[model samples]
Target: MYRFLLTRQWLITLLIALLLIPTTIKLGFWQLHRHEARVARNELIAKALTATPEPFDSLSPAPGTAVPADLTWRAVTATGQYDPAHEFVVRKRTDANGTIGYFVVTPLKLSDGKGTLLVNRGWVASGDGAADYPPVPAAPAGEVTLTGRMRADETAKGSGGFIKDRAGLPDRQFNLINTEQQTKETGAPLLGGYLELTATTPAPADQPALIPEPNHSDIGPHMAYAIQWWLFTAMIPVGVWVLVRREAKDRAKQQAEPEVTPEAVPA
Candidate 1:
């Protein structure tokens, strides 16, 4: 009865089942790790958003120094003059409605004149093509104060894979908001991190829609996906067992039937 287990078809099925068991188990754990990371990030965002706003200089006193990772999304205030000449737009940005857009990135010449800070003013709808740059609203003139959340540079290690620097993009268009990269274009020392603009003193008409406050409320469906993967692992074994039981019954029934011999009429 068990001989059939050695057949090519059953052997292949068993091999496949063996491979799937570990694969599903690993996938489940991978999703669980993702779930845990999202939860932690959400907590951090919530904490930062609730804290009191701090002076940008206090957080980053020195130019070219990246902001501490934990301080990301913390509200910060800075005074600066907008240098529109070096301003550019980040490509492939989107709004809350999933509409494709561009992020207006303007260099803010700090009032102290020490260095410039890249400010992501907000998103503006894109034009027909990459070369057709959207008409960005001019930044407020003179020295003005602004409030925004601090964000880390969009380096490969910093953005958590959300953004990365790309080469050969159109002039005045960028894929990532990297301070180091912008420093070369602006011809000025830049603060390590950029700001997600919230409010500006002497607020001009909002042409580029302001970037909304990040939502930390959703934990996402990672946990549900993880559970689903593990459930698939359990089903694999049950399926194999069911197949084996059916095979055994079929073999036993075949044996129970009486063997018939041909009549010796020809003799």
Candidate 2:
């Protein structure tokens, strides 16, 4: 009975079963690894947020800075005048309640004279009936202080046309990665990266307030996914065995049945 499985058809089926088991196991392990990575990242972000704000000089933007694994989201301070004319609206930002809007970002000139830094002030809803840009209350004249997390500069997407620099403030567009194109268009010496402002006092009446909760990290699910994949891999052999047994039993039953005989007829 087992020798029949050595036939070409059974051999191919076995080969396919063998191949799928490892593939399923690999996918499960991959998910587990992702879960572990997310957990680790969550821990780093939590640590960075709780720590005291460090000077901009203390941190450096090395290559691959955007990797969430390496980014440190900490409280940092900067004194600058927000350049309202050069402001850009990051389109299609959704809030906690799923309301869609835009994030107003502008270049804030640091008082230290080091350079300008991009500030993501907050969000504004686009109401019905008209495409009106929300009034950007002037950044108070003279120097203003801002505290937020330091984010790495955005990078260009594949083929690079996804983000383009416009002559003035963009009306309707989407940018996946920050590019120097916007700065060049504005003719502003914008900083290399952007800052996500968390607390803005005397809040702007029109924009949504920033939420300060740190995102959570969980790695338990990855372990579960890995186990599931391995289980799938293990089930293949059991399934094959059951199928072979059923087929053998059916053949034996057919052989045991009595053969029908033609009835004798008068010639």
Candidate 3:
């Protein structure tokens, strides 16, 4: 009575459902890991934001060196004149309110001739997002002190390393905030980390606004999404069982009915 499940079609369907279990379980864990990573990033930002600010000379690494993990997002200051000729911008940034913009970066030539430091001046609107960028207010001439958070050289998006090219990009627009790539272009000694300018000794007006810290108030709905996916997978086998039982019941009911005899056919 239940041999139908042995048929090729039903057997194939069972196999498919069995395969979905592990697939969906893997998807659930994917979301779980995303949530965990975001939480860990928030913790790191918290610790970095609380540390005391220091001078760039103390933290700056020689050109073409990697910024250590412990120094990332560390607060530091530097005094230098802006190398406006080599200024560049990072594309696809969103402000605290989700407004789209770009972050302008200028290489600051240190006063003591030590080396240059890449400074992210701040975000400017990309309303047109065209190559014709709005004129960036010039960085103060002569020696200037800038206090900000130190960040490691950024890699190209989705890629582990930098691919230096200007194709299809606006003049001076970069896909990443890498310092080594800048060193290649300017032939200047640049620190391993770039500065996120938070303050200036004599602040210049009409410059791009400094980017605020990221929002980490919530752990987000990723955990709930993970649970939902797992629950869907768990119900697959139960649904198959219910369908098979229902078919069996219908067959039993048909057999239970007495066979109707046709009245004797009239000649």
Which number leads on lDDT? 1
| Rank by TM-score (best first) | 1, 3, 2
Which candidate model has the greater lDDT, 1 or 3? 1
Rank by lDDT, descending? Answer: 1, 3, 2
Model 1 bad stretches (over 4 Å): 61-65, 156-168, 264-267
Give one digit per residue, the lDDT tens place, for model 2 in 52-95: 87654345353223424354576666776877776766655666
Off by over 4 Å in 2: 6-9, 60-69, 128-132, 135-137, 156-179, 201-208, 211-214, 218-220, 263-267
RMSD of each: 2.7, 4.2, 3.2
Instruction: List, residue by residue over 115-183, the lDDT tens digit for candidate 1.
Output: 678899999998878778788888888988999999987776666787777788888999888887877
Clashing residue pairs found in predicted model 2:
none
The runs of at least 3 residues in candidate 3 whose Cα sits more than 4 Å from the true structure, single-residue gaps closed, are: 68-70, 126-129, 158-170, 261-267
Which candidate do you rate higher for lDDT, 2 or 3? 3
Q: What is the C-alpha local distance difference test score of candidate 3? A: 0.81
Clashes found in each candidate (C-alpha, N, C closer than 3 A):
0, 0, 0
Best TM-score among the predictions, by candidate number: 1
lDDT of 3 by residue, 1-267 (tens): 988789998899889999999999999999899889878777777777788888876886877777777777778889889988899887777677788778899989888888788999988878454676755677777778998888888765524454343558767887778888888767776878899999987877667878786565678888898999899998989998898899889988998998876675564
